[model samples]
Target: MSVHRVYLPDLGHGDFEPGAVLEITGQEARHAVRVKRLMPGDVLEILNGQGLRAVAVLGESRKHPAGHGKTEWAVDVRIESVAQEPPISPRLHVLACAPKLTRVEDMVDQLSQVGAAAWFPLVTRHTLTPPKAERVDKLERVAAEAAKQCGRAWTMEIGSPVPLADALSRTHRAIRPSARLVIADPRGAPYSPDGSTDLALLIGPEAGFTDDEVDAACRAGAMLCSIGPHLMRVGTAAVVASGLILNAEQPR
Candidate 1:
């Protein structure tokens, strides 16, 4: 089995186990303190989201007088035990567009679910939503949660948003002599990679790519690949292409 695959929070310190006291913090803490109605002595599973599976018993709830309406806090009462994790494989990066609102969130959530190496949100001419750093932060949180839940060995890296041209350049630099680059062009012919050293798969936006964008991407080192008969949404194409890339690289 793979090691406790949870991103961030370190999950260090503490001898985690049954009867151990732990405080839920941040949005997670808020959910537990406010929404869950968890009171003092409430025993719950305190997964560092890393699969430690430490059973945590909540002590008394305390409020801070230092700050105004200071949020609630929890303290772990006891320590149960701890466990180490196994190793996983190297990651594969997923470079894609910000598909606006629900679509973007869904993509972020799903990509992390699938164990992507990293996420690069590109700003193409067809990009309608200008994603703010705050929005990307939300994406990061979502990925972290997904990683914890899905037991991913490493957290997916959320990269800064760059221009499509810049993304093309990055792809060229990322590819090895033996590695291949494939871009999803609905009208392009089907051609898969030769061998997997590492891949930087590109997925375009809803309106797809302009002729200039396609030409630039091709020049930058991406192989034009088709999705067969029908056209797919940028989001759908991303998920599908990601699956294809990972599956193709996997040992048969």
Candidate 2:
């Protein structure tokens, strides 16, 4: 059976050599002990979401009383091994317009699972509801949980909402000067991999992008492409586009 996984954002803080003992506290510890019922000798995988992964054997759990009459849980785990997973190739960054309600949360989870390097909420002309700070926080949490479940060493980054122009400019900066820009639209040609290691995909809102927005994107060097035969909601389109781009066969 695959070992259960937990996220430890501070896994890089200290030495993690074999046989090292690390105490897991806070929300993660509580979840492992209370919810997972992890016991002594149980093996688990811990990820730091920055390419660091550790295999550890569970030790004992301890509880401490708080002043407010609540108890906090902590668990000790003995490190068995540590490894750094390399980032996936053809890094995909998704910039999708915010969908209505909680669908954006689901999109983050799915994108993280599918190996998207990051997600940004695109504030397009047709976008009606941009994500708030609280929603962004929740999206981060969702990404973390999805990373643990999917066994990805690194978590998908959640970027703040940005306007279309800003989004284009940010991706064109020195960091990813070679990043391919793609916009999903019905009028574009079929999607294909161009073998660019870095790619930014834009998915418009339900009402779709305005002509001016499409013109701006094309002017910014974004390729207009169709992801599927039928129209899809914001979340679905993002996932489908990401999958196609991430899994496509690149030129040898």
Candidate 3:
């Protein structure tokens, strides 16, 4: 059986090689000691949430200073081995208007598990909810928790809301020549899976995209693609479209 996995946010991009020592503190520490009931000699997998994971054995537990005269548990771990995973292929990027706040975490969580490279809340003609920095920060935490459960070495990247024009411009500049841009539309071409290494998918809001918005996106090089005849909710369409694209990229 695989060991339980935990995410250590402060571990950063390096220093997780074999034989390294990691000190996990704060809420992560409390979860390990108090919730998981882990103690010295316990073994678990640790992830840096940036494509690196390690097998680590817990060392002695100690009390660490917390804010406002509070104290929290802390733990030390000896890293046994570390491996870095390459980013997922098809490199799926979903750009959409923000859904209801109640559904944001669920949307982020499932998308991370499905291996989306990033999620961008787009500001569009009919965008119901504008992006806020705090909400985007919360989505990051959601992605991290989802990654921990799915054993993903890397967490999904979340972006603050940007205008559709700016988002399209940035995407165009960043994507490679081989990458494909797709917009989800009911009257568009049927989604035929391809083996492209990178894909950028655009999904509109509940009210749908304005014709001008679609025209701008298409003019900027997005191919209109349809999920099916039936309309799907924003979050559902995002997950379903991603899965379809990824399934197409898989070896038959």
Give all candidates' CA lDDT scores.
0.65, 0.86, 0.82
Cand. 1 TM to true fold: 0.69
Q: Over the stretch 85-202, how does candidate 3's per-residue lDDT look in tens digits?
A: 8887778888866789768788888899998988888778888876578777788999999999899887899976667886567544434456788889997897877678888788
Q: What tens digits encode model 1's per-residue C-alpha lDDT throughout 140-225?
A: 78877877677654566778766777667764333344445678887777656465656777787888788999999889778787
In order of listing, the candidates' clash counts read 10, 0, 0
Which prediction has the highest lDDT against the true structure?
2
Q: 2 or 3: which has the higher lDDT?
A: 2
Q: What 10-residue stretch in candidate 1 is worst by lDDT?
A: 1-10
- Model 2 residue runs over 4 Å out of place are 169-175, 249-252
Which candidate leads the pack in TM-score? 2
Clashing pairs in 3: none
Order of candidates by lDDT, top first?
Answer: 2, 3, 1
Q: What's the TM-score of every candidate structure?
A: 0.69, 0.92, 0.88
For 1-252, candidate 2 gives per-residue lDDT tens digits of 678897987658356888899888888889988998889999999899999888999999999775699989989999999998878787888889888887888899999999999998888878887888888889999999999999999899998777888767765332266788899999999887777898889999999999999998898889998988899999999999889888883435
